[model samples]
Target: MSDDDLSEKVGYGHPPKKNRFPKGTSGNPKGRPKASKNVANAVELELDSKVTVIENGRKLKLSRGEVIAKTLVTKAMKGDLRAFDAVTKLLPKRFREPLAEANKSEPLDPYEAEVLERYISRRIAKEDSHD
Candidate 1:
């Protein structure tokens, strides 16, 4: 054999070109199986699912998200403070009532006003004490 042929090693790192995989085909012809639907896709599919609900003694079809929102509003109407907070947070900013404007329109009861005043005074006193 010539010196060039002798110098060309064909072991672990170097395989004969004919033995290598063709450009288009893979060693694994099937290839890795497509990945399953991810968590966000699954959640979106779930939210878009439809369910029947009774409203005003009539059957109604609503999306899962709509049912959840309706339930949240019902709970809030029944004086569930946490549900009310959640409903407010979920509302779009354009639709949400501003707290300052709401407070200005609906004056607090005497007891509530007095309690708020005392709370503010105590907070100020505590800050003064800290200083």
Candidate 2:
């Protein structure tokens, strides 16, 4: 069809000229806000933010990230299995491998150990696949 004929056809997948935005103008003129930060930047800002907490009768300043790590470790120390699992996952491979090896001799609950092994193996496989 000719350009004129195509432009005039406005039933489906096309809108009437009067309803369309004018040529050279935008559907969103203002576009995304200039002040908006991306997710990574926002997360970095939040993790880097300072927090004050009383530690052993003394007030101490810590980053939000540090506070989160402290809380995770504290919960794990109190026998929170989920928190312990999280801590183990966050540990570097050097530390984690040795811990996993040590667990073989220490005798973890059979079911629990099997589940943990499966989870770690799956995580490692996923990470390797990504690489």
Candidate 3:
């Protein structure tokens, strides 16, 4: 019966009183096997913004942030904290080139192949829900 914003009457507004995520704050929240997905700006990021710096025939196009996040999580899951820390430090800088090259030449790494395949299969299932 009023034109005013519904939340505004309660003293909140269009924007949340407090954002769940601080700007640029990264990491997963509780109670999930998967971490955050579908981040913005990252999808719109152009290839030219960061070129694949391949070397020794290994390559990847993913951002350093993405690589570090995946690597750290995998390592942590395997209970290899030292490896996790090492990968966190290394992948963003040192492995960026090799990963870029490796990605270009190979299907997926042994570790990632299955994960990607399963994700694709699930996505396809959802998309073909009518069938």
Q: Candidate 2 has what TM-score? A: 0.52
Q: lDDT of each model, Cα atoms only?
A: 0.88, 0.91, 0.64
Candidate 2 C-alpha lDDT tens digits along 1-131 = 67986769687878877789998999998897787778999999999999999999999999999999999999999988899999999999999989988777856799989999999999889879999
Query: Which portions of model 3 show Cα errors greater than 4 Å?
Result: 1-71, 74-90, 106-119, 123-131
What does the lDDT read for residue 87 in candidate 1?
Answer: 93
Each model's TM-score, in the order given?
A: 0.52, 0.52, 0.20
Q: Residue-wise lDDT of candidate 1 within 1-131, one digit each (tens)?
A: 67876777789989866688889887998879987889999988899999999999999999999999999999999988789999989988876757636766667899999999999899889879999
Alpha carbon RMSD to native, model 2: 14.5
User: Candidate 2 — worst ten consecutive residues by lDDT sum?
Assistant: 1-10
Count of steric clashes across candidates, in order: 0, 0, 9
lDDT of 1: 0.88
Residue pairs with backbone overlap in model 1: none
Off-target runs (Cα >4 Å) in candidate 2 are 1-36, 106-131
Clashes of 1: 0
